[model samples]
Target: MSTLLSLNAQSRDADHMLEQALQQWGGERDLWIFGYGSLIWRPDFDFSERCSAHVHGWHRALKMWSTINRGTPQCPGLVFGMLSGGSCQGMVFRIPRDYGEAVMRKLWLREMPNAVYDPRWLPCKTLQGPVQALAFTLSRQSPHHTGELEPDEYRRIFSQARGIYGTTLDYAQATFDELQRLGIADKALQRLLSYADCDRSVESVAI
Candidate 1:
């Protein structure tokens, strides 16, 4: 992981980060973005097409604690991670070359606007072969970045946390649904959900 991964604080400069990205990926025509989180199911991009891609050294983990979404400010919520360790199978979207910059900008604005994410480029093995794609990692600088949390705490927030987006339950439901539909039931994700406080409801509703 690069130092950028350590930039999980809430005070990053969005414009500057975008400019750096533009420079890094400048002149690229068709763009492939690897999505392992909410993007796996709910892609907010207008893409020309999508294909499967495999990225190594990272798998989804519920390593992040958020006070604003799944959990309250005091209790906080938990979110998944593309943490380094194993490989992740996810979809890669092909965005138009001319619109790549704009589309990338939209992605950054949606995810990295707070500067809490360290966006980086990684090589994704796509149908076409290996291709570089944009991905975001949590910053170590973030006060909210918890390397580990108690199982009970993980469950309480996961069981009750909600946000402007929705409840933590909704998040789990969405991810489980998407992964199962894709026939990619990631074991790590299942284990994370297993730590949640609500089982009866999750057992019936988890897809």
Candidate 2:
């Protein structure tokens, strides 16, 4: 996989921020990181192995709304949230302490570039036991946020928008495919495909 870099000034300064975080960790060899979304299938870093894990107090939801990719500015598409008081089943990868700085920098560049996320140390429940891991949560209070949308409005936005990568349908398909590959599924996301009002043949988002 390719390292994530900002294409413009508006992007979040991910590389710098991640380096700072790694420096704080001071190169702990036992460092492990968990990924649930795009990173689950597309991690660019070198890792020895990964296994199923779960994090409590957060659940992935399409909480972040964006018209930039899936809708117009007037109507944005939804993205994930590690909201409070829920649990998510995902995978965690262990990074060698020596490569911490580089791997952390790349991860921050990819996911935290927009400064829309707050990386918090959370406990990841692995087969061995609970391990401390840094998990990025979308800032619900950010001024740039579009707030939560009604399900109907969300459907409308998904039915429209085009992103930097491609159309909203493309976003949906990519997410669906990746999630299934991980053997994980969300009922909310599945429900979305059935409720969204778009031409499936042309503009449909996969379930």
Candidate 3:
């Protein structure tokens, strides 16, 4: 159908654009990528080194609505969005200079399919020093971006939403667990996990 063809065309165009971004952002040395969410647990790429880094002015929150990976149109599940304020502690991935372009392109394909994130080579503070790392932060202007959501809305989505990737609870729980392992505590995620626990219990009784 025309829609399918359009999607394919968009993918191709995105690939081409990201290929260009790689060249521009990679710089003369190794490239660093900052990850705070799924990237922390599943960075499916080969990185030369990983460092615990911190970035100010952005904190991860469940502010993005997913219609595919974690939810559907009727009950969109929530996902992390790096919002402006506070600081975040997460892992930074370093890609070899020669492999920068290829890795950037792959990352773009994975994260930018929906164009919901604002990708930039941001400067992060790491123990080694400072590095300009590629980061995907939420864009407030995007339709998928929800600057804020009610507590009950989160409970509803985590309980009812399921997508191709898995259950919303699973996604939230995994992220919370990974953060704990990394010595980073996310209070908001912890609350979501508790809500998910309640949801599972309620489902159990119904079944």
* Top lDDT prediction, candidate number: 3
Candidate 3 per-residue lDDT over residues 32-106, each given as its tens digit: 889988899989799999989988878787788888888889878877778767888888999998888778778
Candidate 2: how many backbone clashes? 8
Model 1 accuracy (lDDT, Cα): 0.73
Which digits, one per residue and each the tens of the lDDT, describe model 1 over residues 1-207? 322422334337877787777777775567778788788887888998877888887766767766665667866666665667678888788887898998888888777756666677778887678878887766444665787767776677676787767777678768887888887768866766777635656777976
Q: How badly does each model clash, as a count of residue pairs?
A: 7, 8, 0
Best-to-worst lDDT order: 3, 1, 2
Off by over 4 Å in 2: 1-20, 67-75, 197-207
lDDT of 2 by residue, 1-207 (tens): 111222256335665556545655678566777776666766888997788788877877666755454555665566565666678877888887877767887777666656777666677888888777767776557654556666666666666666665665566556667777777787767776655534464454454
lDDT scores in order: 0.73, 0.66, 0.77
Q: What would the TM-score be for candidate 3 when compared with the true structure?
A: 0.86
- How accurate locally is residue 50 in candidate 3, as Cα lDDT from 0 to 100? 96
